[model samples]
Target: MNLTSVDELFETDASREDKQREKVLDIPLSKISDFPNHPFKVKADEAMLEMADSVKQYGILVPGLVRTKADGGYEMVAGHRRKKASEIAGKESMPCIVRELNDDEAIVAMVDSNLQRESILPSEKALAYKMKLEAMKRQAGRPSKEDNYSQLGNNFSTKTSSDELAVQTGESKNQIFRYIRLTELIPPILEMVDEKQIAFNPAVEISYLTENEQTELLETMKQEENTPSLSQAQRLKKFSQEGRLSTDVIYSILTEEKPNQKEKFNIRRDRIDQYFPKNYNEKQKEDLIVQLLESWYKKRQREQER
Candidate 1:
């Protein structure tokens, strides 16, 4: 019942077919317990109210989905608002389509339902993609090109049973791969991707970047207008390969494909350090401390501003 626990969300009990067809007739809302949404889509109050008005006027166009309760009540799946609106309208019994989905099925169903609205969070998409991939792996023992993922109990992978998930989803292999890459990005940038502040291709390009590089580009991205470019990605690769890339270079590559950036730090170990103790804090300690403090200050500043 808490959105913070992904484990709990994915571990819910599924619905059974016989239970789905058990014919729980016009169950009164009062009799059926209210199920609060952990990950709710209730933000658009005007919209929910509008939908409620529609439900009140013409009745629930799409039957609310529910699951059978052991105590002779029902738990909601989809259409929480419709159930709520119907109850608000003082209806004794509300129409519903009862289904019993397992934990995984429930997660998939909840994700799919949320996807119907304006936009789904990138974090949600990442989890959904991961769920499907795991489910596909379970079904076929691997991501084989032959099996139809759709036929499986849960098609969590981007593609159906067949390896043609790209075709089925109407996305390019690159795009699909890019979406999967979003899974690798840490939360903040992923949130940025969900906000539509960052475009898909550029974000994917950034995902391939290393943590340091990603952190670097993310800092630059805040000050700059658009996200990094393909050219920027390539440049980053080149710099990283050249073994001289810095946070500045990361920003430069992302913002301008220009090689105006230079490595910010260079460590030159003295030829005599071999005789010192491995655990010793030598004369270099003071300088190293200053550098560490500078980095910490910058990080703290970013955190505060954020």
Candidate 2:
């Protein structure tokens, strides 16, 4: 109401507007580079298509975060999916918040930003945890307690880097290490874990097998048409540690069926994938196969009756 009060209100409004303007910028997609070894995937799946459609109609409501690179342009710290969606939406540029961040800070920010997604593959979480844990250790300048790689089975104290990550991410320190161990698995085995062909617990135990032994196990699995259960995998690990594991030993262990283990028919995905549409997921392909099989069986029954 007074002259002084009016001037103060006007100054506050001007400062707020200036701050808002400084926070977001319309950055070109070409000028932005994805983060190095970004663990999160930006696939053109159903959700991504929906996001692209939304971006097309409404524009990018939430701005991406990036930091300036030394060479030139900007490095994306978050919002990789947004970038891809914008591209699909025929957008040349999207809103972003530019900031100054060191390598460690960038790594932490990237992991934190992506971890909240509803669906994350086991491999993605494994690599992301390893990267973020290493960055957290570096940021501290000295190892607190996680340096004891062999003793990860033991309960970690509050002073450890893993403990801090556990608190921040709501994953137990033991579970975090379990996920991190997955990084040591061979790509084929890791892919199996991602596809849900291998259970998570058994896969973690299998990670302890040496590369050669793992190769042997994979071959044995193919020959037997069965995968190792958790108990079988633990026995393999024990044999490997005792220095007695061999191709024969792996075959022997894998062949001994567990209680209630029934015979299973296995088919390599690549062999059948050619018959299905590109967008068909595993369930859809399976349903179609069952439908075809039922039709063939009914036709055979009619012919036999004749």
Candidate 3:
């Protein structure tokens, strides 16, 4: 006859209890704290307002995840937006599944859950990737009994935590590194990247500038009303590394027309203003000219295709 060992029976009982404790519970919003240094922004934009209305009518379809804090109350691992929606709906609590997770584990879970969102801004991705990568490195440092394996579940074949993250997130290691570099950018300049006023490649290149240099560049951009092109950003970075990126140098570079601008049709505003209505402002006239040129270019392209 086969007999179950005492340790086996005890382990089974513990596992069953753990599963039972995993059920959803109504956690008071007041008792739940946001995750430490949560990188994702919780905006009350149209999507969130719509979610609140749905929640007010139908209630949350999915529960959030949280874990007990050492001091008191629970810390959110995921579902910050749902919590916000619940608040907007005038609810006292939201449903959440409490879990047992250490700091590193929670960081990984929080980042993974938020990364699944349909729309994430570049600054959001930048901070999230940086946080997750750092957490992965910390987890990797813990000694493992298995050969060449980390607590993060990465095989040493991947070489580093960044490489492991690249494999999981489907971003090249270099690309991941570039995103991480964005965390170093000053807030105003970083916001420009998020707003798409500064293109991604140029923004990443600008991230290398010293904080003071970046601040100077921001002032220069405002004065010139022009952002850097990739070529100009490269030149700035080169000068920065050589310790010669002065405020005057920044102005000199920014005031210079970009390479793309060099090929643009040039006409004095007054020369074209006579073709527009007398009341039309400079901006209106310039915009009309651009629209007309775009239409002409598209028509030419279609003719060439034919």
Candidate 4:
């Protein structure tokens, strides 16, 4: 009866089982659910189609990460793209690394994983950062005076949740705050920001307006066929804060000429090409025009001096 050898054998078996838990398992697609409120979009564009083709040929090389739910189904934490590709590739099951993560942990992990993507929409980052920041704050427990100040006012002190998020995402703390501000905007205005019709700084300022004011501003913009400049948006934000912003005020501000605005002159490409040699490209023509302008200016100066 060698009890020492039996104990050693049991220990070895336990280690093997632990290692097995870390290995990939073929999870039924029906058993896996998408992460709740997943901010990232999986578009079925050319790239996705190419990915599906690759998956069909070689199978999924990287295993997806998932956690078991109470009802025994799995919830995907990462690899949303892979999951979709697998489905397109006609896979009944996907290879997954089963993990155990709580709500806050899952949120942080999900944000961290998706933020590495090459092309993320602005709205996605805004919502993801907001989710991660809230999760971080919850993990850290009760709100401090610093949280109150950051939420109520523009000033952010040392190492706020936004600051920590900035560190994680490689964005400036101010930029993170600006992105979060976008969440307050009406959906149409926010969508305009995502579409790049409204610039980031102007959109940030516009986010401070109330919903009714934002709708009014949108109408004014549509009527004028113009978006706000940074300075104009700042003025709008100021007016909104003071409760003085109205449709009339927005229209007036938008209609006012900007100090540095220039009247644009248009010349047809054919009209410009006739003045230059046949071999001259657009850049060469532009250089020649600039040279002629400079020469004319110098000649005028000489005549005035004489």
Candidate 1 on 192-300: residue-level lDDT in tens?
Answer: 8888877766666566567776777777776554465556655665676677678877655555534565434433446544645677564566466578889999999
Model 1 scores a TM of 0.53
lDDT value, residue 279 of candidate 4: 92
Candidate number achieving the greatest lDDT relative to the actual structure:
2
lDDT by residue for model 2 over 1-306, one digit each (tens)? 645676566677768687656478899999999999998888999999999999999999999999999999999999999999999999999999998899999999999999989999999999999999999999988664555433155664547787788899998777888998898899899989998989998998889899998998988876666798899998999999999999999999988869997776778777887999999976798899999999999999999999
The residue pairs found clashing in candidate 4 are none
The superposed Cα distance between candidate 4 and the true structure at residue 27, in angstroms, equals: 1.6
After aligning candidate 3 to the native by TM-score, how far in Å is the CA of 224 from where it should be? 1.4
**Superior by TM-score: candidate 3 or candidate 4:** 3
Regarding TM-score, does 1 or 4 come out ahead?
A: 4
lDDT of 3 by residue, 244-274 (tens): 9999999998878665575444465556656
Worst 10 residues of 2 by lDDT: 144-153
The total of clashing pairs for model 3 equals 0
Worst 10 residues of 4 by lDDT: 144-153
Which segments of model 4 are wrong by more than 4 Å?
1-20, 144-159, 259-306
lDDT preference between candidates 2 and 3, better one:
2
Of the pair 2 and 4, which is ahead by lDDT?
2
Better of 3 and 4 by lDDT: 3
Pairs that collide in candidate 2 are none
Tens-digit per-residue lDDT, 1-306, candidate 4: 745676566677778687667768999988999999998888899999999999999999989899989988999999999999999999999899988899999999989999988898888888888888889888887373344312333454556776677677788766777787888889888889888999988988898899999999998887666789999999999999999998889999987888888764546565676778899865788899999999999999999999
Q: Which 10 successive residues of model 1 have the least lDDT summed? A: 145-154
